[model samples]
Target: MVVSLKEAKLYLRIDSDEEDTLITSFILTAEEICEEILRFPLSEFEEVPKLVKQALLYCIANMYEKREGSYYYMKNEGGGMAETIGIMKIILGNLRKESW
Candidate 1:
């Protein structure tokens, strides 16, 4: 749980407790996606890097905002979300552990 429920709520602009469970789930999903992208378990790190944390925030926020969509439409619609994901991917790539 790199992103706490409080942080997720704050990012989501959710001020009530009614959707806490849902928000928590989104946070977990985001963390899993981030870990997958990084090719390493986030728990292994003593402290999550700031860039990683930002990436997680973006991922969670994107998921929360677009839960209704079956897939992320990454074409021509301002491209903000797609660009965010692209930035996250680059951050994850730089942070990923290399195995020999």
Candidate 2:
């Protein structure tokens, strides 16, 4: 994945081992989302790009901060989480341009 468990924990300032598994899941989920937005598997690249790594870190951090937030993204949705997800998409979309 783009971000390691250790890196993620450090990034998130989480020192406890209790959330290690959760953080790992978030890392994986962020990588999957990045791949989806990039239109290809990250494994296809010989070396993953720095921008992609940064994007994944941002995605993982977002999820960690809003662990209890809702995942509903409706037309009338009006919250920072929804908009934050949209911004993540935009960031990956730009990466898609350079990747393709």
Candidate 3:
């Protein structure tokens, strides 16, 4: 099943138990991976764009961090920033690929 981001966004708002779990897992796992990346001691040595990408992914995957239209905080558990971001982007990329 190819799910567009728009479709995923719609699914995100549904309150079904199964959909809730799936959405939570998607966001949480991405956040975890981003957290992992940010924790790395060598992260500074990498490209700034890569770091930004990680940060962005972390931000996007975290729906709860956002409140009233702005991101507020991370869930406080998971991988560092980099890992979370990387994982999110990877997931998003994969999801995009699935549409093709």
Q: Rate the local accuracy (lDDT) of all candidates.
A: 0.78, 0.78, 0.43
lDDT per residue for candidate 3 within 1-100, as digits (tens), equals 1223343445345434554545545545544444353443223434434443444434544543332332333345445444545565664452232221
* Candidate 3: worst-modelled 10 consecutive residues by lDDT: 91-100
Q: TM-score, each model?
A: 0.80, 0.78, 0.28
Which of candidates 1 and 3 reaches a greater TM-score?
1
Candidate 1 structure lDDT: 0.78
TM-score attained by model 1 = 0.80
lDDT of 1 at 56: 89
Q: Which residue pairs overlap in candidate 1's backbone?
A: none
Ranking by TM-score: 1, 2, 3
The sequence of per-residue lDDT tens digits that candidate 2 reaches over residues 14-89 is 8899998889999999888788778788988888888788888888888887777655533345535556567778
**Candidate 1 lDDT tens digits, 38-61:** 878898889888888888888888
Highest TM-score scorer: 1
lDDT of 3 at 69: 35
By lDDT, the better pick of 1 and 3 is 1
Question: How many clashing residue pairs are found in candidate 1?
Answer: 0
